[model samples]
Target chain A: MALLELKSVSRHFGGVRAVDGLDLVIEPGQIFGLIGPNGSGKSTTVNLITGLFPLTSGSIVFQNEDLEKLPTHLRLQTGIARTFQNIRLFGQLTAWQNLWVAQNSPADWAKRGFFSRWLGGQSGVREEISQLLEFSGLAHRQDELAANLAFGEQRRLELARALATRPKLILLDEPAAGMNTEEIGQLRERILKIRAQGTTVLLVEHVMELVMGVTDRIAVLNFGQKIAEGTPVEVQADAAVRKAYLGGGE
Target chain B: MDFYFGLAQIIGVHTLLGLSAYIVLLTGQVSMAQAGFFAVGAYAAGMLTVLAGWAILPALAASSLLGAAVACAVGFPALRVKGLMLVIATLAFGEAVRLFFFNFDYQVARGGVKLGPLGGEGFRQIRYFPENGWTTMQVMLFIWIFVVLVMAILWWLDRSRYGAVLRAVGEDELAAQSVGINLTAVKVSAMTIGGAIAGLGGGIYAHYTTHIEHASFGILLATFALAYPILGGLGSVFGTVVAAIFVQGFLVEGLRFLGDWRNLLFGALIVLAMNLRPKGFLDAPTLRWIRRVFGGKRGAA
Candidate 1:
């Protein structure tokens, strides 16, 4: 069974048809890459899956559960998390606090009464937060506000926050957007490490080197529709994919 | 000393109102309904004790609960709108509640014989301390104790995960939602808690003054409450506390020496404050400085 399945998903922003008749299946523990030209509905698909926007038609199934009715927060509780294409950390919060807030689950909130919750949980939460800070290489700078961090560090902090959710499947939207080569290499290693930990990844990137180097399977989209899906080499050689990228004579 | 104590009591009550406003502001929500909730608390406690013949402590509790109920009712729908629309919705709700209480009519009759008019004209001459055999000093002490308790609770919340989440929601609702924070729940809870705190203040205000009037909890009071958080700096709880004390406690009262010219002085002060320190006197930088002086670590982010 697929970890995530989107069948004939369509979203129309007043006839714009941002994502039209899209069908996709992401297997469990697989690193799936979604790529497309500008305006090819890549981000829209991510939004639809995460319930950021209501789908005009169709269904999204996650772990055999229909996600049509769940709100974005509920979807997140069900072990799905994502990073924004543009970084959106809580700028006023420290790096440690950013990850700490993300670690909150509805279950944790329900477990204790109001006063206990206000006092914050036991040592477990603190330990987990420390681990996440160390994992993101932000332990030394964890006290710094997120807005003060360098861009690359902010991106890493966001990734760490997503991981703190303990998500079953994580979505990365252009994780390597404005990074140097060294940073990209680090991010690739982190993604591989994330996959090794048994969490499935759905990466959406315009950075071909990162996508091709890291993803197990790749899908190409053009004009709100999937144009190709296969291994990286097969997708690279597909005639339609080549035409979509290089532009044919219509 | 008595005069200073009385002034301190008034300041403490306003501080509670300011804290109530601070609660909603923490979620980046601008609600001008604190006066409405304050009225609910005042009337509920007053009527419960005077008419229904209940004890003071129980009446206070009931008032707080009623305030929370009214807030949740208003918040469920009011919070659905955002920015200025939400402000308008809350303001309208506050007016509607005030009008409801103003026009309320209740009469007790025995066998068609008229008893008394207990509604609409406003509950007056509520002799809370005299009738209960309590001293003004005791009541003042009572109000300040709760003030301290509330401050402690807010301080705890400021350091907790709940506070972090509220700040996140305030900073960026979209991003907060993306992280799985329940925006509606966070917002509604903030409103409910804020209303309860204001209601508690109202109960104390009614008992302390030994009177209740509909006109006292008007739009002007609500607007001043809103200004506390803005002028205090929306960044921290300390900002609200300091702003409420300086503005409501000192500045407003201290300007009375100028008599008729006080309003002009107050207006000028506000304008200057807006121009000179738009973020309020007790903002992040100032807070950091205070922390540094006290040898305390960890910024108030």
Candidate 2:
């Protein structure tokens, strides 16, 4: 049994099927990469998995429990966290503030009794937030608002923030979208380090070099359906994936 | 202590109002219906003291609670609407409430209020506490000011982990959900805080005035109350305090010109501030220099 599993999951937008009858399994401590071209339902699948948008049909079982009835933040409490394809940092707050917020108590306390939870005798939460800020290498920029960070540093902060939720499963949507070669290399190292800490990574990236270098396995989607799923070597050699990318010139 | 004594009547009420404005803005809302809530608190408190024979301090507390209750009721209509629509809802509600008070004649002093006639005595009697006199004022102002320090409590909330989720929602609701934040709850809580602050201010404002009138709370006054925290600076609690003082100063100084131009000048300055400094004049980089100038005046040399 895998740590996260999806069986025949589907979503539709009033006639356009964004994600159609998809099935996937992600094991613990493994680096699984999801790849597809534009309009291929990769992001939609992520949204469905995170419970941001409800699934039209089928089932998502996480840690051996059905997740269809769960809310988005509850899923985070269940140890699932994901970053966006586009950067969405809170520009007004400092980098450390970003990580600190992500490290907050579960939605239950924030929901039922925020004042008590926020102000109770618990001082440990504050200390924990401080430790995370330093761990993310953002201690220096703790007071500097998020807008002031450089591009690559912002990406790293995003990773730190996702990690702040202390998720067993971290989903990366285009973690290397706009990085230089050296930065991409550094990102590869960072993703590798994240995995070594016993956190499972499911990355969706278009950077073939990084993906092929880091991902143990790759899943390819072509127009709302998984066309290929195998080890990186088998995935690259698959005839259908080659045709989907290079338009059959291969 | 000397400054508090000098500023006396306004300090507590204005601070509460300013903090409310700050909370409303934190949730990414800009409300200008504070004058109406102030009226609500004043009338409720005044009526209870004068007609119901409630003690002054308790009456004030009850008034603030009444204001919050009214604001919560108003939330249903306003929350469903978004920007400009929400602003309109606030204004319409303010106007409707003012008229409701204006026409409310509860058979207190002389005859009860009369609707449509537009020329009848109001329901509640104007309270006058003599001898011990200013004691109620002192208690009301001091105790409520203590509550306003609860702004520190709000500051803590805004800085906490939950605060980050709210800010994420404020900055971008869709992305916040992706990170597992419930957008509706965050937005509503912020709005509720904004409402509660208005309640606090309303209670203080009522006790200070000792009488509530529709003429005192109109669309224009609501805008002024909302403007204070913004003009001071929305970034810090102290910023809101400075803004309230600045707005009060501007109103007095700007009105020194033409006798009839007070509203016109107030409107123009607020529009200028809203346009030139969307975050408010205090957040402007140049304001740091202005603060230094003021600090110098306070014997900082």
Candidate 3:
């Protein structure tokens, strides 16, 4: 069964259709890529799926549950998490603290007495955070404020923070937006590793190299609609995708 | 010693008010409605004790509960608006509450004789301690105990998951929301807690002063209370407490030597403080320094 299914979803902003008639299905453990030019509603589709914006029409079913009525936080609690297009770390908090905040979601804990609620979870949470820090290659710089980190490191920190939520499906919005080539390569490896651990990844990126190298399947969008959906090779060979990108007569 | 006790009592009450402001500010919501909550607490406690013949403890508890209820009621709609708009909404709510108190009238009477009205005249002669035969020191002690308890709770929250989520919401609401932290819940909780704290302070203030008035809990008091967290540094709870002590407890009292010019001096000092230390006296670095001085283990920067 698909991990996520969007049925004829449409989101209209005034007269403009930010995302129109979008149908998508992301199966469990699939590394899916969403690629499009600027203003193609790529980000809007992610927003719709994650419940950041209210759907204009149609339904989004995540793990067989209709997500239309769920708020963003509730969607997250249902094992969906996303990174921002622009990095949105808690700037003043340390790198470790950034991930810690994500891991500290109250819904994850069992209802307990006051003292146990306050003190009981520390050791386990601390161990998990340390492991995440190590996984993100940020153990040494865990003490540094997120705002003070290098751009690549900050992006990596955001990835780690998203992973800290233990999400079943992680939507990564342009995770490699400002990274250098080597950093992008590292991000590709990280995405594969995340997928290998049974987490589905929906990557939205303009970086074709990373997408082509990492994603198992790709969906292309143009003018708020899917132009092509296939394996990377098939998408690369699609005539419609070529026309959309080149602005040529189909 | 008595004079110092009085000073301590004022500092404690103001500190509670400051902490009240700090709580809502934690969720990046600047609510002036804390003063409204404070007023609710004071009036509730005053009217209950004076008219209903209630004890001090029960009056205080009722006042705190009423404060939380009023805050939750205001917060539900008011917090839907963000930043400056929310601030204006809360400011308006505070003014509305004050005006309601100003115009409100409640008459207490036996079968035929007319007793005094409670509202428009402002609830007065609320002598909680005198009836109990408690000394001024005892009253001061009582208020300070709650003050310390609140400070301790806030301090614990600073290191707890609840505080982590609050700080995250304050830093970036969208990010916090993405991580499954319910923005509205955190925001409303902050406001409710803040109101309850302010209400607690108000109950103490009513008993301590033996008098209550609508004008006493106005915008100026709210503004000063809000300034405590900012002037202390937005980074830590201790900063708010220290700022409250320095500004309301020490500086305001010390400036009295200027007599009629005291207000002018106080304003000038605030301006100078802002200029000299834009981040306030106890920013992250200062907090780190203090932690190191006290041999506290430092966490990740």
TM-score of each: 0.95, 0.84, 0.94
Best by DockQ: 1
How would you encode candidate 2's per-residue C-alpha lDDT over B238-284 as one tens digit per residue? Answer: 67766665566556443667788787887787678778778666673
Ranking by lDDT: 3, 1, 2
DockQ of each: 0.58, 0.41, 0.56
lDDT of each: 0.85, 0.72, 0.85
Docking class of 2: acceptable
Ranking by TM-score: 1, 3, 2
lDDT of 3 by residue, A1-250 (tens): 9999989999999999989999999999899999988999999998888888899999999999999889998888889999989999998888877887786344455434544444333444677789888988999998899999988889889999999888999999999998888888888889999999999999999999999999989999998999899999999999998888878765
Better of 1 and 2 by TM-score: 1
Candidate 1 per-residue lDDT, tens place, B134-179, comes to: 7667777888898888888887777778888889999989889878
Measured with C-alpha atoms, the lDDT of residue A1 in candidate 2 is 62
Candidate 1 error regions (>4 Å): A105-123, B107-120, B133-135, B298-301
- Best-to-worst DockQ order: 1, 3, 2
lDDT of each residue in A156-179, candidate 1, tens digit only = 999999988888999999899998
As for lDDT, the candidate ahead, 2 or 3, is 3
What is the Cα-based lDDT of residue A154 in candidate 1?
96
Question: How many backbone collisions does model 3 have?
Answer: 0
Whole-model lDDT, model 2: 0.72
Q: Quote model 3's TM-score.
A: 0.94
Count backbone clashes in candidate 2: 3
